[model samples]
Target: MRDIHQVHTLTEAVLDPILAREPAAPRVTYYDDATDARIELSGLTLANWAAKTANLIRDEFGLSPGARVAVLLPAHWQTAAVLLGCWWAGAEVVLHPDADADLALVTLDRVDESEGVGEVAALSLDAMGTPVRDLPVGVTDFATAVRVHGDQFLPRGAGVALDGMPVAEVLAQARKAAARQGFSEVDRVLSSTPWDTTAELIDGYVAVLAAGASLVQVVNPDPAQRERRIVSERVTAQRG
Candidate 1:
């Protein structure tokens, strides 16, 4: 396992080490109240998804360093993979839908809003990774497209990170946020916070990675399930 303090980029520094040491340990656990769905991703599993997403961006989409990919998804495990994948592919993740992006990722409900993008992929956010059917002519189904991509990625360069921020800067912010949030390497963090902005992404998601902590992310959370979830997941920290 690589030393967390000695690492730099998000994937290379935080995730890769988990792959080397804790391949089977759960890194991210996701829940959706509306669908009554839950998904757990181990370190190696998350890396595989990130790598496939990277391959889809680089090989299938023909994107390279500095390319902007607009992401209009919510807080979920797939969103985590998408963010890491873009960084792994040396592409920047643009949060807004109309950011003049080369690639756009959105949910089915927002597909109509994806104008001016060179390419578009709609995610179903399905627990079973089902492909979205009946998509508009130009939209690609992320589940279907990503399944055909490779699971081992070698980035061509170290591109800019979220919203044009540098990788080092983002990772540094994550480290600080982890400390401020009282995160530790052994903590199992439970966060209901949405990664709607660059700040939230750093504070909520990246901090867990930086601190070598596990995350139990809940979207559209059910208050009644909160206590049960914490107990079931063995959560040690809480944040919203």
Candidate 2:
């Protein structure tokens, strides 16, 4: 049997259990412009999308295992999904507002300029239209990649269920399952406070995404809007 130390990536740890579950079960929720979009992500869909996106990164930028990718964007459900996708592809993700340049340098491979900076790419998120650059290497526009790849992805691995289940119980089950699968300590993440305070991310997100029930990231502007987000989105976690 493989020991916890042997596990290498987040995809290997969580995919099987998720795939075994029902698709209609709610996996995550996001709030945009006062509207909430809840995704009932089955294990199959999550695994497939992550794999597809990972493949896109691999093929387009030649990112290998252990490469560092920086994602500078808001904490939406899709952002979380993309982070999982990066882990699935065997790469480390650096969240936005990262201040440690040395830490960022360890495995830096591709940087999505549309989100922030570290490297340059063809994609830009500016609505007013910024001038495009013709760079020789290291930059990518994530939106374009998703567009080119299309929405459908091939599924991989078996699935599990934590749907409609209490957060605590789901976490316990996932922890036991992950331990059996040989996933130990993954990373020490310092997420930008308040938003990162949720039990879901610390308990479920990081533990399930990274190996060994450990790991994890940011943001500002809008107090009244933030309050609405908490109430509408059901974010019961404490605000910093």
Candidate 3:
């Protein structure tokens, strides 16, 4: 595996090592409450999704470096793809839909109601990442469009920072936090905190990635099922 120390940006520093060292290792496991849906993405698979989403943002939307893309989805696997993809496309990610942004990726319900968003894309988050059958006039279906794109993406320039913090600093802080929390490569970290905010970027995703650990996230979790899953998945640490 490439040394995480040599990487500059969050994308390269956090994700690339996992993809290189253990491409097939279980990286992210997600559970949704409303539908009792479960989805898992390995290192290679997550990279592929990120790449496709990057292509969708770069090619279809014509968004380049310095552009802002608003992400309005919950803490699903696809949200991870969209977040990484935005950084891969050299654009900043805005968490709020109303922020000044060039494009917006949203859930199905928000497609019709989100006004003033430059362009709108919808994600179904189905088992297959399916596209909506009847999208309102101009909304792009993310899942369908992403499938046709390439599985790998290489940005032309160096990595960029978010929220005025250098990417390297962000990783360093995450590492310190992870150490304090007793996280390590041997641990499977379980996080129930909503990964929709900027705080989660550091505390949830970065911390786990920095430790070379995997994440088990439960959305709308049932108490009984959560206990079973923690044991089944061998989760060692938790953040709720």
Candidate 4:
């Protein structure tokens, strides 16, 4: 077996394991109480999104490893694609608004109002991955732009280390914590936590990927629907 760390990119380490598993299995399911939206992604479908987004970042944006990208969207299933895609391109992800970034990704509703420090992209996050109805003046439609790219990517270079910790170290730490928390392939995790902090970074994103478990994410959750989701999704663990 090839060592994932030998690949020299965080994307390779994080995605390689998941790709080795059942591609047809459910990888992420998202529910939005405010919008009454539900979207589910199989491992293969999620990977396709990641690959296409990575190509967009690499080919269109001309961003190289270590370039920072601000992901200004909510915790929708599409956010998963963006996060994975950024790592796949060997770029760093910045969720904080104040952070410096070379590119900015925002929700379609926020496109006209957003002032990009550099390049801007709009994500519809709609059930059908539709393009925005009224695209902002300077923003590219993410769903439309990514469609032309192929569904396979190979990073051309290695990513730079962040704060003395490389991507490999981050993955290792998240995997260790996930293992200690009893997360595994057989478990289905329900994450109600907002993806706005460090804990959410490790627990919500990295841990689920590391554990090879499916994630059921709730955005603007409703208490009444929680039990129904837990039962329907076969959730074995809860995090908030």
TM-scores for every predicted model: 0.93, 0.50, 0.89, 0.88
Pick the TM-score winner.
1
lDDT of 3 by residue, 186-232 (tens): 78988877866767767887688789899898888777787888889
Worst 10 residues of 2 by lDDT: 100-109
Q: Write the per-residue lDDT of candidate 1 for residues 20-115, one digit (tens) a residue.
A: 777899999999888888899998889899999999998889987778888899999999898889878877787877748999989999887678
Whole-model lDDT, model 2: 0.43
Residue 93 CA displacement from its true place in model 2, Å: 1.5
Model 1 quality (TM-score):
0.93
User: Could you tell me which residue pairs clash in candidate 4?
Assistant: none
lDDT, candidates in the order shown: 0.86, 0.43, 0.78, 0.79
Candidate 3: minimum summed lDDT over ten consecutive residues — where?
1-10
Q: Pairs clashing in candidate 1?
A: none
Clashes found in each candidate (C-alpha, N, C closer than 3 A): 0, 14, 0, 0
Better of 2 and 4 by lDDT: 4
lDDT tens digits by residue: candidate 4, 1-240: 443334467666766777787888889999889889888898888889898988999999998877777777878898888788888887777665533577888887655444645788888887787888877677898888988998898876545423334587778877986987789888889987776665567778778878888899998899999898899899998888
Worst 10 residues of 4 by lDDT: 157-166
The residue-level lDDT of candidate 2 at 147 comes to 46
lDDT of 1 at 73: 94
Please say which candidate is ahead in lDDT: 3 or 4: 4
